[model samples]
Target chain A: MDMTFEIIGWLAGICTAVSFVPQSLKTFRTKNVAGLSALTYTVYNLGVLGWVVYGAYLKSYQMVVFNAVCFAFSFSVLAMILRYRRRSRL
Target chain B: MDMTFEIIGWLAGICTAVSFVPQSLKTFRTKNVAGLSALTYTVYNLGVLGWVVYGAYLKSYQMVVFNAVCFAFSFSVLAMILRYRRRSRL
Candidate 1:
């Protein structure tokens, strides 16, 4: 693979990995999650987990790092949604 | 790459790509997007577009196909958020 292509892949990975930050921050700030879906987050986390496994299988450092970071952020958001939803129900 | 690894990659890609369907369906059914973030979607679209470019550079058909599907679904959700926000503001 060309070095340039590798750089592009890294760039893409970074972008995708960090894409959840703004939303997570918003959710943290607002503590509002009426628009968020638990089912979506659950499935998304599973997908990210699959990517993590695939990354390990392929020995792709970029894939592993990117998806790992994404999984953490996504998991946090999912946790927040669960917390908020439970609180709201009470 | 091992064929098994390729299969895992495709599985991961499919999971990630189709992950948005449930959320999009929920939004469509409920017509509720109070929790969706326009900024997040915008950045996400950019990220997915970056992935598309990176996929093209790598000649990875799976990457290209997966991100293309993701981009379409993310865009529709963004559009819905915009529309709903505008209507709600009035």
Candidate 2:
């Protein structure tokens, strides 16, 4: 096993997992997805769903756990944005 | 081979790849990372780097191409954030 790849995996996993912070912060702070694109969120949500399955198939806990958390967070933000958008439109 | 997985893979692949749009948009539109976290971006950049390698190892073109594009986009945002952060602080 290449130790470098292992390190890479951990690094990538953590980074990808944590990368959602800005959006979350923005979502929380602004309480708006005014500038955010709905299409992007929809696509991302689908992607996270994919990661979940991909990780499960690979039997890699790292992929599964990381993507799961990321998915939850993304979903939360997406929901918030959608709610805010709907309320604003109404 | 499960066709379901292939569909899921494409969905996840596209979702994950396109998911960066909001961030990219925010980065470009806002012209600031004021609300964004540097640590998160740092970790994410590293994660994209790992994905590049992981994709290569798995010989999955979806992984490689999607990650490569995402990496470039993420790196661009990261760089912009760093530059903006520095300018504002100075």
Candidate 3:
């Protein structure tokens, strides 16, 4: 049971971590900001950052690592939105 | 110290939970998924579902609840993507 839960947790962490990959790629490739929400990514990145801090406090290495990974993906997405949105304006 | 961490956790949870709202709303209102990635939302939903299950095992109310909220938002976004993409094709 312990091992089972461990697998489940890791799977959950991996899923959460990798979930941003497709969006990041699509957004970067297409450079479309039409449907993406800047507010969502901004707040999401902040939350992910907070999770990294909280995880460190709790010493939950998985959370720290995965959320950090997630943060990178999301932060890049946010940056893309800002960049693309700016370019679109100009 | 404990209270501080607790507050941090809840704030993190709130951020994660509400982060999806803007995207969902924007997607629904604009009906523009061009910038969105179906694979990302699909995998993200699955990951969040996993979190709900893992949280249940740990009896973490916040995890279960926040993740459930996140799931709903992401799921709707996924559904909207399918719906709109189909409509777009037709």
The true-versus-predicted C-alpha distance at residue B57 of model 1, in Å, is: 2.1
Can you give the lDDT of residue A80 in candidate 3? 96
Model 2 over residues A14-62: C-alpha lDDT tens digits? 7788777767777788775665556666778788878899778878888
Worst 10 residues of 3 chain B by lDDT: B2-11
Better candidate by DockQ, 1 or 3: 3
CA deviation > 4 Å runs, candidate 1: A1-7, B1-7
User: Candidates' interface RMSDs, in order?
Assistant: 1.8, 3.0, 0.8
Tens-digit lDDT string for candidate 2 (B32-82)? 566555665677778888988977776778888988887877677778778
Measured with C-alpha atoms, the lDDT of residue A32 in candidate 3 is 92
TM-score of each: 0.88, 0.77, 0.97
Model 3 Cα lDDT, one tens digit per residue, A9-76: 89989998989998999888999987889999988898888899899999999899999999999898
How should the candidates be ordered by lDDT, best one leading?
A: 3, 1, 2
TM-score values for chain B across all models: 0.89, 0.88, 0.95
Q: Give the runs in model 2 whose Cα sits over 4 Å from its true position.
A: A30-32, A87-90, B22-39, B82-90
Flag clash pairs in model 2.
A12-B47, A15-B43
lDDT, candidate 2, at A74: 70
lDDT of each: 0.84, 0.77, 0.91
Per-residue lDDT of B1-90 in model 3, one digit per residue for the tens?
988987888899999988999999999899998778999898889889999989999999999999999899989999999999999998
